[model samples]
Target: MKKIELGELLGQMTVSEKVGQLLQLAPMFYKGTITEGEITGPMAEMGITTEVSENAGSVLGSTTASEMIAIQEAYLKTNRLGIPLIFMADVVHGYKTIFPIPLAIGATWDVELAEKMAAISAKEATAAGLQVTFSPMVDLVRDPRWGRVMESTGEDPHLNSAMAASFVRGYQGNPDELAENHEKMAACVKHFAAYGAAEAGREYNTVDMSMRELYQNYLPAYTAALEAGSKLVMTAFNVVDGVPATGNEWLMRDVLRDELGFDGVLISDWGAVKEIINHGTAANSVEAADVALRAGVDIEMMTTCYLENLERLIADGALPVGLLDEAVMRILELKRDVGLFEDPYRGLKGDVDRQQDILSVEHREVAREIAADAMVLLKNDGDLLPLGATGRKMALVGPLATTQDVLGAWSWLGDMKDAVSIEDGMKAQFDQVDVAGAMDTENVTEAEIAEMVRVAQDADVIVLALGESANRSGEANSIATIRLPETQYPMIDAIRALGKPVVTVLFNGRPLDLHGLIEASDALVEAWFPGTEAGNAVADILSGRVNPNGKLPMSFPYTTGQIPVYYNHLRTGRPADAADAQEHYVSQYIDIPNQPLFDFGFGLSYTTFAYSNLELSSDTITKMDTLTISVTVKNTGTIAGKEIVALYVQDIVGKVSRPCKELKRFTKIDLAPGEAVVVTFNLTEEDLRYYKPNLDFTSDPGDFNVFIGTHLQAAFCLA
Candidate 1:
């Protein structure tokens, strides 16, 4: 049927039926029966006779395959309208065979590998009776204290856009295959607007950036996801400007729907619509329903506010019937797209071992390759990396060295039993290494510290694996200070004091304050939650099988006071000129340096690379033309390695101020010993465009500086 025809059919329905389409309740599952008591009982008690199926407009969590099938079957058998329920799960990384978090995957910069990971996740989730995943959270975050940064792609908008498109394509695949047997599930892009720019890096707080900053810094990923055919968009819990995002019509209607042409169902984050009452924006459930419905939020996730008062609002003339039909039609269109209207039992099978063939050996091999690629080498002074297997008595010490903390965060269904720790990975190579936990097995003690120090004295080199736990840096896990916990500091000090060479393998979800550790360790490797095969991948890099080419996705701060520091910040007029200045009126702190512990796009390898003079295609160009910037990168050291040639752009003069540097493009290339290659980046008007005060995007014709460098400061921009 045509979508407008479906809208007309929905428009003729009663108020209760239209509200029922917007209410997505949680299903109550039992041993053998899935009844409507939890949802339908409330409906009947509230005098709301018109309702969908028992499982329609609901989310199911943590159910076995058989149980899911039984519940779905009962829903189909008992419902009057026979609308198939949309089964959604938090398939953040992997469904069952878990991978690393999205930030770690972004470090790989391999779009093909990321897409393969999402495809495998979809296969596993589909086998377990899931029809949708709340995944590919594309919010661009620069602050490390925000706990949800672990779930995003990274700070760069372009890279986040690329990864977002790749993930959607992987999850949805071809529409033809999805038309057959519900071939693919829907990918939901989340936190609809600017949840990442929360004040002080707190989660679910107020976001108060200008509209220009919002459009330029945060909206690219959402736009890319829409273009990639994502069928659902989830609203954030934070308040933008002074209004809660769940109730902001300007964001949902003007920005997302009218501007971006997103016609998909707009779903709210868990209980966010109701929580707006606490945000001081809504007076009651009725008011909340009125606000959200008018703002274009079609689906109420886990919140019965819409079902409770949506009918009353429509009757009281606060909401129009046409708005309700618009929402219902969008929901029904998704149902039709998933083939649910055609075959109600399409994804309701309990026995899906046949579909388990999707998780093949090729998938596991790809996971290993991506995990190896995500590992960033932060510091490798004097060639301490690629440790030879012969005559190396290595001492591996730290609490996380042998633990399963490398799974990272939001690995909802990752098998902890199968995860390999750092000690296990290092043991496969050397036989003489002594493994000692830095802290107490149950609780940290002095004796454990003494043992770690004693073991460090005997070995030729010490390998310290230090990082945060998988649970310390995800949702509801925000930290006020991004420093190392006091418990791990003693072990680090003791190991560094042993006077032997120390290599620190840092495993973390967000960027950490590592000034002391950076100065103490001879070499540093950032293995940010390499998944189940983390150990094997680390062993491969440390043993010279795979070269370390991963670069920092987020800046590592020297102190927690510099919480939101990033490389693309603008230069103020009164910026500090002297590094030794004791006072400044600009954005400078009194005690701490403004520089980061490690800059973004900064990573080291076993070999050295040198960047020579940069050359451009022409000094001037017309408005319709493009420019090519070229630079030569040579491997100056003995061993072969790979380097990421980064290109940034700076607008010297504009109607409004601009960032000091913006990442335009980058390419990762492999080089043999003493080999050199010239890489080029083509830039058009799109790369130079900026949103004006009137919200128009245009590039002013002026002299722009193009920078080609390994790091941000070590670059010469051509005028």
Candidate 2:
């Protein structure tokens, strides 16, 4: 269909039909789907009608191709224009063949691998008949206390931007090609404008920050995702400045649409429009609907505010009909773009072969590969890892040893029974493997600890699978203290007392306070949530089948006291010296050291790497000249491994205080034993640009120090 046809369709829609096009509800509200049921209480409460339900532009949460087909097929019978309903869901990480969580994908530091994982997720999700995924949540998170940090890539804007673009490309292919492509689904970059910086790291708390800070830190990744051609943006539940994002005109219109040039669908985050009343921004549902529509929100999700009040608002001359026409046109264009106007089901007509498409062998292999690459080796004391499978009797003991809740949150379509446990993967690799532990982390008993110790006594090495359960992190799951449950400490202490070398594998979603666990374990693996291939990936790393190459995307704090520890932070006047702890009047904690337990970009390999011969092409350069940096990395240990070389820049002088070190570029390279290779990076003037105090984004001409992997430094001047 042509653009003029969309205009014609918009012109044909009545006031009620246009309002219905701006509303998105759940599939259960409609009939003929798998979850066809009555919600009389909710229906009466939200004032929903059969007419509005049949004419809703989209559905939020429905699984399976048959459900989508049934919903669309049944709905078209009632509508005069026969518009198709688009199905969207929170397919955050994966659909059926689950990969590692978004945070784990960031730890891989491989943008290509991240893109591959997302492509596989799109393949699986589209096979199940999903049309849009609320994914690649590009929120820059510095606080691990925020449970939604698992949804974000990390603290750095640059890394998150790179991952965001990669995810968009994987999900939608090219924006121009998304219209005709049936294998991929549309991508929605969510929680727009600093939802991650909620005060106190609490979920849905107030997000108060200066506009300059917002632009400098929180807004870049969202801009990058939009630039990469994401088709939709989700409004955040929190407030931007003093106004809720769902009803903030300056944020939605002046910033997102006008400045960022995003003209796509803007949907509210699960009744965020109605909740604006709770934020004291609106007096009632009527006011909320009027405000949200004027603020440029295209869809009111999970609420009937638009269905209930949009027509009245327009009749009272409060809202122009042109706004409704514009919104309806966008929805129609999206429908036409996704080929829904032509084929409402979008190739989901026939019975989908689950075995051949959903969790096929190819998909599982990609999941396993990504899961292994995403596991970061946080610690390895005296080379205790890579246990020899032939001679050693390995005992897998912990709450997560045999449980299949390895696929973490937002995996709506993933079944726990299909997930591989640590015990299952270990037994496949080793003939002598024993497992004994509690099945639940919070419900562990003394008897379970005693049994775990008994199993550890007979084994040469212990592979302790521990960490937060699948529910401990994700949206609305924030905790005050980012520590392991107290109940599990006894299990850790008991196994450590056995004097067996313990290689601890953590299945968590956020950075944790690892003070006690670090002391009790010989080796530590930060396996965030490896999805369906959890056990096999852990086994590969433990048995020397795959080397651990993942790095820390977020810093591990010493304790919860240091809640928001990150590498790139503004310089202070009086900096604390780690050499002198007694010094006062500095930014240092009295009880604990200021440094993080494990810094960002910190990871280990079974084989070690040595950096040498740092050189720069020139000491000075103009704005137009590109500076070349070179460093040689050697695999010092006697094994093949991948090394991540990180490059950071420190601006000596700027208009405002700048971060002491900021990551500019990084690369992952494979090296064999005793092999060396020169890694080079071209640094242009664009790399040094930052927002000034007056909000002007430009690079400064000053002295800069380039550090390679936190050690080798070379001084240069940007002239």
TM-scores for candidates 1 onward, in order: 0.92, 0.98
True lDDT of residue 375, candidate 2: 95
Candidate 2 structure quality by residue, lDDT tens digits, 1-719: 88988888888888999899999988778878644346555666678877778788999888888787788888999988888888999988888998899999999999999898888888888877788999879999999999989988899988999999999999999877766777888999998879999999999999988888899889999999999999999999999989999999999999999999998898899989999999998999999998998998999999878888889999999999888888788778777778888788777774656435888888889999999999999889999988867888888899999999999888878998889989898898888899996868877899999999988898989989899999999988999998998899989999999988999999899999987799999999999999999999989999889999999988988899887899999888678964555478788888999899999988989998999999999999999999999999999999999998989999999999889899889999999999999999999999999998888899999999999987699999999
Most TM-score-accurate candidate: 2
Model 1 lDDT tens row, 1-719: 45675666665656676676687755453222444465566655433443343424555463345656676666667555666666777888886566778888888776787888888888777767677789889988988999888898788888888889989888888633554655467889988898988888888888899989999989998999999999889999998878999999998999899999999999999989999899999999888888998999999887678877877877888788788888988988887777766665565453545355434566556767888888999888888888877688998888777786678788866677777777888898767788887443224467877888887799998988787888788898789988766677777888888889998888888999887788889989998888877887888788878888888878888888887888888777767764655455666767888888888888778788988768877777666777877888899988888887888888887888889888888788999989999888898877889999897998887778877854322322233
* Least well predicted 10-residue stretch by lDDT in candidate 2: 33-42
Q: List the global CA lDDT of all models.
A: 0.79, 0.89
Model 1: worst 10 consecutive residues (lDDT sum): 710-719
Candidate 1's C-alpha runs over 4 A off are 1-14, 29-55, 62-64, 174-177, 181-183, 345-352, 355-360, 438-443, 578-587, 711-719
